[model samples]
Target: MPQANGHANGHANGHVNGHVDGNAAPLPADLIDPRQVKLHDALHRLRKLEAAKDIDIPQLIVVGNQNSGKSSVLEALVGFEFPVDNGACTRFPTHYSLRRGEASTTAFIKPGPGRNEVEKACLEELSRSIRNPTSFHDLMRAVNAGLGKKVGMERTGDTGKGFCDDVLMIERRGPDLPQLSLVDLPGLFTASSGHQTDEDQETVQEMAETYVRNKGSMVMVIASAQEDIHCSSGIGLIQKLVRKDASLNERTIYVITKPDMAQSFASLKSVVDQFRFPRPAHFLRNQDSGRDRPRSLASRDAEEEKFFGSGEWVGVPQAQKGIAALRTALKEMLWGHTKNQLRRLIPAVQDMTEEAQRGYKRLEEAGRPDRRKFLVDVAQDFDRLIGNAVIGNYVNREFFSSFDDTSLEVRYKRLRSTARALNKRFATAVQEHGKTVVIGRPRPSGRPHGSAPPPAFLAAEIDRLYSYPEPESKCWADYETWVAGMVDDWRTGEPRGQASSMAYWALFEYQSRGWKRMAENHLKAVWMVIDRFIDLALAEVCPDDGVAEALRRRVMDTHVDKLRLAASTTLESLLSCHGRGNSGFYDSLDDPHTSRSRAQALISKIAELPSLDGGGSPRNAPAL
Candidate 1:
């Protein structure tokens, strides 16, 4: 075979004649035909690589109507006959690889997946039977057996008794054969017979479409010159596929068979002129007698020469007619296409190999136990969630944004701010609404105008305050009891005690109720933060339904409950201290009108009073 020979031009180095440009250098006499040999070998390697990777390799697909000279064209190209019959002779796809060598043929059947050992053994025996076949009939019998067909089964659709999609591969090598590889799919048909159902017809069409529709394939649509071009044949089907992918017209080749029998060339000429079918259409006479009658190689050649020399085809381009012309056209087309595909194929195969390696490495790592790494990952995720909850740096917007107009994370971040605002409101409610008497204001005309003793006035004001329940108080009984004690203390106070004790208890009780409500609200806000944190963490760390549920049950549920309880306890304790009277009550007395400077000296003694909870003296109370 012609070698690359350090030349940049592929056709220039090849021994193939007429394929190269006319001005290219001539070839040596000893060189093998590169068009036939080099191209075939390159394509063979590509097919092998594609099969190994389970990728789609480029192909030349043959499609035609039943008994439309499809088998004749293929047999003529391959320089041999395998099997052909009247109606739908080929049920499954048959791939032919032709080359120049000794006259020999080998066959192999690639049964599709799920075949048992028995079926494999049967296929192997069938292959052996085809190798030493005495006649084409023997080949047909082996093909039927390999496809799992019974001897008497009718050739129906793919749903027939022994229908399969597995390819029947045959490699034929002989002298003067053009190097070519082609797949002959099942012929297209319109109506179904008693044996072939509508399902069968569809199956056959589907199998044909599978090959012709491949973008990487060069589709050869065969139509008998005697038949209507617009009929529901393989040509029409090819046209449909070409329409869907306009680029296919550049790769598609139309082959007109049985041209000698065509009654009128006017319709065919119009089709070619209008570009109805993709050209160049090669017209050939493959069969002179019936389909079953075999023609000798010399006789076939003589007939082709006679047809071309006749007056009917005088003006037709020599390159656009005859089987020999078609063979040359195919070789040239395959060479150019194969070169382009190979250029692209190398990088694609490399990328696929690298990707597969990465996937394998990942799978290998997954097979090993790495609990330490897993735990570290979980810890990292937990820390991230805590950070997000505290600082509102959430990643998934859907987790919060989709739940409501405002996200849960945003609300969680606002918890502290919301609590502070409520606390301020609580203080304002205490300052404006909690006071029963204005220190500098006089009594109204209809009310008791005369001032009683300071102790008696304080007791009457406490009664009025406790009679109407404060809107914020949760514990009314405790408040009433505390008020009664304050009144009693004021009544029993020493003479100078009036200023220090004046209405302080009523103000203290009112402020305590406001603080209690604020504390409860703050506790609820903290609970909401924890709840949203659990939701955010689960969504991030355990998005799977099962994993999230397990985490919620095993970890989040108990953990959040404990957090809620602890926060509730802290807030409740703070509120409870406010609810009971504090020693700081005397510190709130700032009135300078009374003669209680000496009583202020006694205020320090009352400031050290123990709390009602029996805990140590209360810490300095929060500012009202």
Candidate 2:
């Protein structure tokens, strides 16, 4: 291995044949073989850092379905429960340390569009969409109204349709162990059962999958034994993970929850036998236990200690035969043959003396005239590399600009038109299929033959439609909610909460009558927007050429690695915006409005076409 010699300045001291000499001059590019030169330099640097050992503490990522006792199990193991309320406790992946006394840092990992990021983007969108230049309060009202309508909310609130509110990270340090770290991820399915709850469920599922796919850390999946654990949605998640890189199997652990829910000791045995998962563990907790009454760290530790025992001992028996048996099974799992059954790979350290000696002599005399020609050729490679980079960048930029100025607009318009056509097609499709979207209002035995409604029955039918039986006032209320939320843009801010009101009425109307058509149209519009956004994004993120390629070559070449480091530092931030997980202008919805802010705002508001619920004023209604 090569080492960093006294000639600290790699460039000034100039390496000869890949070795840096304070007194020696750099060999001409024509004299050295680039391959040997590169290898020699790399070897020298490897020698310098060879003495340092990098140890990364393995992080255990714990996640599962909502209320599947995910947080409970983590709190039980890590010796503390994070803050739990009626709402979710963990919104994003957070790191927790077992190292005590020292302050544990709380780190949150969230998906794209964080709060500040989303807020800025939304504000920008609102500013652009709303035509009127109003006070901050009025602007907020319009924004709130837009958002409320989009999400079908009764009134506008502080939040919008973005999921930034769902992500958070928390870290805690423990005194006893410094090496162990745990990551708590948000529950898979949400506990909330609302109209958009399914969407939330899908989002959470995607988030979990993305986390799992990117997880360099180990994983512990907690599940309830009582739930139909083998359903497609449940098993699909597991199957997808098992198919990831081979290392996953070794790092994964399955935990069955709610052992206390079992009927008897025999049944518990039967349950464990049925799952047949290797080294599976079970936890017993009351089904109705309030999340607020979390056990203290010490108490949970004691309980864990009792069940699995310490690293050394086995748990004792108790009068509750089932509990004792479960503990015994768990202990066996932790320390007995079951654990040892899992295959593990530990690499054997090699003895370097013999091989180093054999390679050293050849490596020493490797820099002859023939090698020099090779080295020159290698250096020459940098020129072509840089050339390609320049070309790639130029082409990418041109394409990006083209997309932005022309291609993107064309594609967006096409997609928009397609989507709208599809929506219209769906309506035609429904009618062609002879599907009458009936208004579920009280009707006589049948419609009398000569009594015809108006030609503009679309709006009137929606107004009279009632999916559920209710009084006239309630029907009107539902209508208002429908009308207001329809066409409402939820990305805007509402200073005075009027946005919420507008959304309430708009969404109700939008969701009613011709819903299939509406959905088809909306989805088409969203797809078009996303597609254009993605195309423009791809264009703007052109690869940097000269420096990037130069650095790549240097890193590939010899002992002094200044080029690679310099190049990396130079390009990291610049290219970061183009990476796979990068966000675009839509994500930056709150950015300040640039051009036509008022027009954008006005267009967005007019697009919403807010309606009144029950065709009555909210100001006149008494509090429910």
For each candidate, give its TM-score against the true structure.
Answer: 0.48, 0.38
Tens digits of per-residue lDDT for model 1 on 1-624? 211111011111211121222322121111224744665566566666533445455668988877677876765665544365434357777887665666666677766454433344346556666664444545655687556542213353444443456677877655555566788887788888765668768878888887777766788888876666667387678677766888778777888876665666666667556655555778877654443134454456567778877876877888888766787777666666666666777777788779769766765776646545654676577666666545544454543343344533554433334334334443333433343332333322331222222122123322322223223333556666766676666563545535334445445665445455444543443343455555656666654454466667687777765765686688778767755546254333332223245476656555588878887666764221
**Which candidate number maximizes lDDT?**
1
> Would you list the clashing residue pairs of candidate 1?
none
- 315: Cα error in model 2, Å: 11
Q: Deviation in angstroms for 504 in model 2? A: 28
Return the top candidate by TM-score. 1
Candidate 1 stretches greater than 4 Å from native: 1-36, 49-53, 86-88, 113-136, 145-163, 271-275, 290-294, 352-624
Question: Per-residue error at 180 for model 1, in Å?
Answer: 1.5
lDDT string for model 2 (282-337, tens) is 54442234321333334433454454443212331331122233333433322322
